[model samples]
Target: TGINYEVVALMAIKTELQDHYNVLDNWDINSVDPCSWRMVTCSSDGYVSALGLPSQRLSGKLSPGIGNLTRLQSVLLQNNAISGTIPSTIGRLGMLQTLDMSDNHLTGSIPTSLGDLKNLNYLKLNNNSLSGVLPESLATINGLALVDLSFNNLSGPVPKISARTFSIAGNSMICGVKSGVQPQQSMSRSHRIAIICGATVGSVAFVAIMVGMLLWWRHRRNQQIFFDVNDQYDPEVCLGHLKKYTFKELRASTNNFNSKNILGEGGYGIVYKGFLRDGSIVAVKRLKDYNAVGGEVQFQTEVEVISLAVHRNLLRLIGFCTTECERLLVYPYMPNGSVASQLREHINGKPALDWSRRKMIALGTARGLLYLHEQCDPKIIHRDVKASNVLLDEYFEAIVGDFGLAKLLDHQETHVTTAVRGTVGHIAPEYLSTGQSSEKTDVFGFGVLLVELITGQKALDFGRLANQKGGVLDLVKKLHQEKQLNMMVDKDLGSNYDRVELEEMVQVALLCTQYYPSHRPRMSEVIRMLEGDGLAEKWEASQNVDTPKSVSSELLPLKFTDFAGADESSVGLEAMELSGPR
Candidate 1:
């Protein structure tokens, strides 16, 4: 009966929250326990112990029934649109240790009942419209280690607290002046007039001198400086667990980026394997074109977006380093290398990736992209989604890396325009001609990635070998129509793959790479079809629609060529052979 109560409470809580992306679709009411739900975690005895759903764009009010989950030790619901007052019943969770409800539209005063949580260690209620005086009861929590109430409408003098870190910045109404401070006396009229006259004269002289100095400095520098001086000083770089390493530290770690330690090179940068002083292995990416006008801006944007996007399948940023002449990002080293390397290279004269691993990689990569496009606050578009950018961890799990060309799209906007970037064969036709990109563009590239996985060959190389003017995609369709897919399978697989699964994967790839971006399915839908849920229905619908012209025939003729005046070695790993209209 107690467990039944917990389920009922969870169901009530779910009713109050909006799930925009069908993320909570699997939270079945008929389930025996709430522990099997997507975001709910349970203890050894099957009591709900945690609820983690961050950056999911969830809206609506938090249900007070959440307090019924007395076993909950942590609750993370940040980077969302949830609003309304904090449920006072939350104070009933005696075991709660971490409570974060930041970056939302929530409005209300801090609940005094929060003080009842004796075991609370971390409390974050920042970036909201929360007002009212700081609760005095908060200072009474003996085990509290951190308290952040920044960027809100909080007012009044702060109470003395024992927490190791406390932030109250951005609250303009906060009174920092202690009690019993005397006010200053007014100045005499004659003294004020004289002071004003003196200040005005001094200001004029200072402006004249400063203007002359600025002209001289500009003449000497000859407009060489592209980035703003203030761009290098982001407080977020040092906040939280992200470290800010010095240039000297990174240089020593990779032996000054020796050629022998190079892991991979792309158009934007080169990745070097580094060994930290703490005896940890790391991959250091040194960006090129750091002196270009928008280089630093791109670097800053990537840092901010990647830091916020936390998922197991996406590459985790360990730290970063930036200097006047150098920009570098640090990530954990992958032992299994990139998917491209594994498929193309062999170890001990045998294929490194088996048929089973290939299917898993495809699904894992889709889930990561799904999170980026649907779950994140500002949807991310990976302009380049190829096998080279999909890395493998020790356990052979796919980790999507390389955010050099990634763009963030607001939920209200559907697309963004920029210069043509990405590999030749992977670039979507619409993106190539119009320079406009959306999540569909990523879907198109992922389709190419799927073909890469199936045939264990590079798209461009396979296209060239086919001798077909319509490129690799056209050849794939031709094979599928003739029931000759077995001939196109990777020779390394040697008839070891499931025939039904191969046909399903091929159909999904064809659907994804359609010439019309509107025809491509969203990553979430693709995931379902891949998992054997809706492929038959979607494929039948696609077949009913008028078949568009071949993917390559719809675009202008393209010829692979090197970027003018670009070092061949500095070209992007996936974009080495860029294509231009010929």
Candidate 2:
């Protein structure tokens, strides 16, 4: 159903721009020949490239049309009143170099696809109502020389552009050193002055003063290390005692933080393995100093919030230490390691967490997240939930970790973050479509985790080596379509597993993986479906859980527009065929 790569590219851009401009009325260019369009641009050989439609007053939802502009090098749709999101299709525009949508009434978060433009040097998003954090993915483009994000409602710390052409003027909430209005940076500078002035110098005392200041600074500056419990309590000011440690002490525990003790690597740092003096072992995360605009504040805020999280299923924070350059987080170590490790290792070498173990893990993880989402005072959203981050204790109970990107939402409402930072394949569809992260996003990742547990394959893998042509879900869908689902179960589970139980799990997983977030089940509902079908307990609770409930209004929204030709009520015969019961 896809057009030629070139036509697909052209259509994608036109569709996106049209949607942004509300210009999609009767837009039926059914063929691949975009050269015939009044709004399109083309090169000498008829290869579609560049789309320049300035101030068309185009209004409507952005179409997937932008994917039509394959050779498109520049898209200049500045000065329009377009009021929709940029489509995910635009990211497929591999050759796009300059995108100018400045001064448009475009609203919504910036697309992560824009980060796919490696050759992009000019990005003009100034004067729009674009809110949220700038995509750090865009920072991967070191060649970008011009970026005008001025006058937007952007917030959070900024990134240092290599070309130094980054502009953040007029954005009331935007913050960064390069943007010249970062409060945190200004505070650090003021603190530095205070330290230098108070600890004065003389020629003979100068050398000693410099050494003392350097050492003290090294001891004082805290990197946004993992959850350090001591940082939560200042014994001199606060009442309760906090588990605090100096950078030197942490360095000593991990043998000067040796590589041999590394637990895992992360977005802003590396997590090391360490043991406490009380005969307990822990995982310590060390923050890497990337570009400072977004890094330091994010680090600081992360440490502050995570220490306050107290839940049985939540990863416990042992402590943390901050030095001038080093930030380390100490966490109670899990004996079985991560879920991903178990999935990868040979069962004989390191026992593959069995299907039953995997289910309990998923259920426990859902409950943990549900507590974060519904139980916490300021409902927290675990933005980065995945198998790798889900640690397993000796009993295989999943403990969701990583609070660097965690967010606290107002009661009963969903939490939305600026930049979309999540693993591929696990990211929710709506998040990719609109940059809205909610409890639903975590739910989507949990759904993928469910599928992973069943199939023993990566969420996005095609698995050609396993003689499968698509992801595990794709294989499952194909099997259902081919009426061969019984054959699709993992070979490891022969007669040992009950067929009905497997079927039920697959159904729950499929519901979780629905294309839209609103369509997917909430974690609470998911728990019910898995534990016992509380929604419709009539479902067979066997391992196959094979019962598909009746299409109630809550279950599926089936409208005439969903089927082909059903909306053409006047066209009797075709409409009748389309309207027939599914």
Candidate 3:
């Protein structure tokens, strides 16, 4: 019966509103359940908990029948043409936390009954035609975090809501209370005229200053300036800087992206080494139009992350170029290339990386990851952490690059649901099955990278190694079990690395790749272990007790050949193969 009441309330709202956009075309009154309807979220116990219908272009008074859904916690109806006063019956919703009816044509004073909703946290009634004194009872809601009542015809003293995020600007008539009483009577006509005259003069002065600044900017924009390699120019705040280059200039730099200028290619894009007019070198990444899913979104994300994230080990984004036919990202050139390329060169009889350089790169990459996970505000999780993404500069220092598949997490959030990303063999087992990513997922990828560094092996080599049929993870575990850990070291690094240090690093990698997310050490802890913190002993003792449980019921063999050239766009098509019924 309560479900029916919720359904009826929803239908009444639909009938009252003039839905010009047909956004609510699916709200059929004949439906048996409103919980399944669009924009209606229900609790596990089958009660309507949230009704979100913002920017729906619907115009009408909010139906008072909404109060009948007593279990409602959030009622969001912003950015609509809805008119009339807010239904006072909404105060009956004791569990309400959010009440957003902003940017509407609603009138009348806010109901004092709203004080009854003690759990309310957000109350937005901005950009409306409401005219009356705001209720003082609103100040009593202790949990309120935001209260926006600007751009309304409300008068009298402002309420002290004690909210950290409060805004009442644009409501010129609103005034503050002093000593718990309203201020004195209105000012004299002459006093008011003087205030207006003063404000007008100040506005005119501000405009004149802005015009002078604009003219100076135009003059600078007309000139060409060259910056040195160490300039560290940032365009976000710096005005009149030559931060952006034309597509024609970039095209000329790479000699039309000739094969000789190509640095590397991957599933998403190809990178080229280019020298600008001033002899400064840069790496130009031209994303493939087909595989760059949400191209504009990815472009903006990469720019934002690279610009905001500044560390010695993080690649610096020089700038970007977006044309009708191309999206190009520019970064400082790394002469040593990527870790993956270096490892491949070692396999091809090039000069092998000494043990010291390998350790240095590992530590540097760990620091970059620590910055992303713990240092940045609203931390970022690099969903695609692999050897290919770790570039090496002139001195062979590691610079963690690539943020196309990155996800942002609030400090209070533990994980986020997203499409499965990353190289097939480097993905964490938990993330692969549940589509949930956290810092541990990045740690898992780093563990795979450790294996790549130690053994000089790819994460997913399809039966390439004569002795190993399973992936690098399986081979490392097998070698560790046999106590022949030295056999897992890169053949090119024979006797070049300390036996004791190699064993310890392998053990740390094993600890990081533990199937259970809770069991894996944080990136910060991993950093400590890399710096000789001696936490490997606890990891070694725990290994005997913790068995690797399968993430799914069936253990299916995944082959690298199956995804040899496929990109992220095709991951969803074959997701079922890697992600079993979990």
Candidate 4:
């Protein structure tokens, strides 16, 4: 059977690996079923179709036995320390659609055998030490839409591939074929002689201009830290369904950048409340110091992400504006402001968020995250998920905003590694330590937001005394341990909220914040748990609130690194600063 073949195939792979982090600990050779193993995905016919173990910190060579599984459709092992040559046998998989081995220490030339993958659509072999000319057959794959072979030692003439489908930049040695209008040969001999003389002078001028252009290009390249948006934000090419606004219009709307119109300021820029000529109220985010590192990247990312994202629960991107000195994003003004502001209002004698509204907000936010993590064509991971980013409409419905640090995860790959983003207290431990952010990292942030909703505590309590140094997570653990979790409930609500419902929500939050990424439930499962179901009831029974776990022993010590004023709560447009590609 295919299962037996897959089981032995995986065993051979495990046998060759170093497994430094024990990520493959669950891939026990003695296991009777390989389908049940971690990272293995089986088809309906019980044949293994996928093996994804990206960003596991794994090392060692990829075993040739991996090609033994004929039914495999995807093989993703990116973002690890795995080294060695591309196995030629990989080409034997005729059904393969994705073969991602990027961001590894892989050496040698890309296997020409990969041309056998007739169904291949995405092939990413970037950021490796790979050498030699790319196989021309790779460009012949009919269905291939994306092929990234950048940041390598590759040399020779690059294949004639469309600019939209291939990325061969960053290879110093690779030369690209020129494509343009051909010169005319119909000129007379005298005209040709005159043209040659003119050409001689033109060539000298061109050489001088070329030298100047190269120097200018190097200067521009150094100035741009992340992506060179010099050509990325061309509305005619990249913008889809997103309105492009003129700088003059937005400048006039914000009343010539009046301080009174300013709503907030953060690491990225300032946000101002503006009234358009059409008398429509909108919030405009103006990138602070447009020349700063990663600023342009953030602006481009927000427009790109919000343009692609379409969800009622997510904040809408109305349009954008750009000028030589400024970049701005426009959005519908939220009259009720953000959840963080509402929580602060409640703390300062304002009307508190009722239990029903809080529940609705939590549920709505989860649904939005579910869409980002699972429903999006290329799954998105919201690296900066926080209460401040969750704005509320006048109807009190949640609107999850700020996708600047959002990452588009490939359908076949797992997680992506980048610089750490997100608020201090809301970041997951695994992400903080390894720089890898995934759907689970977002879940951790959501868990923190849940605790904030239940207890009305800021993610980072700047005013807490040294003795009360613990954040909301610590307080919840402490109260639960003392069998007084009810004490952690928002005191503003008194006894009006249902004790049973509150306790169940707390349990779900705790589960979502589990230390290990795999231990956290998916956002979809979380929604099911929040809404009373078999899983919810079973979880409630397992917790048995009457006898809670001791917080001192069960919980790890809450160690918070002070981001000082960097908490999202302090920012004017809290979501804007964290918006950008990681």
Best by lDDT: 1
Better of 2 and 3 by TM-score: 3
Tens digit per residue, CA lDDT, model 2, 469-545: 33445666666557665565545554555566667777777777666566667776777677755534423222244
Q: Count the backbone clashes (under 3 Å) in each candidate.
A: 4, 47, 0, 5
Q: lDDT for every model?
A: 0.78, 0.63, 0.72, 0.71
* TM-score of each prediction: 0.74, 0.50, 0.56, 0.56
The candidate that wins on TM-score is: 1
For model 1, where is the 10-residue window of minimal lDDT?
A: 567-576
Order of candidate numbers by lDDT, starting with the best:
1, 3, 4, 2
lDDT accuracy of residue 506 in candidate 1: 97
Compose the digit string of candidate 3's lDDT tens values, residues 78-164: 878999888898989998877888899999989998988887866889999988878888888877656888899888887777665
TM-score, candidate number 1: 0.74
How does candidate 4 score on lDDT? 0.71
Sequence-dependent TM-score of model 2:
0.50
- RMSD of every candidate to native, in Å, equals 7.2, 23.1, 19.5, 12.4
Q: What is the number of residue pairs that collide in model 4?
A: 5
Task: Compute the lDDT of residue 382 as modeled in candidate 4.
Answer: 82
lDDT of 1 at 509: 96
TM-score, candidate 3, is 0.56
lDDT of 4 at 518: 69
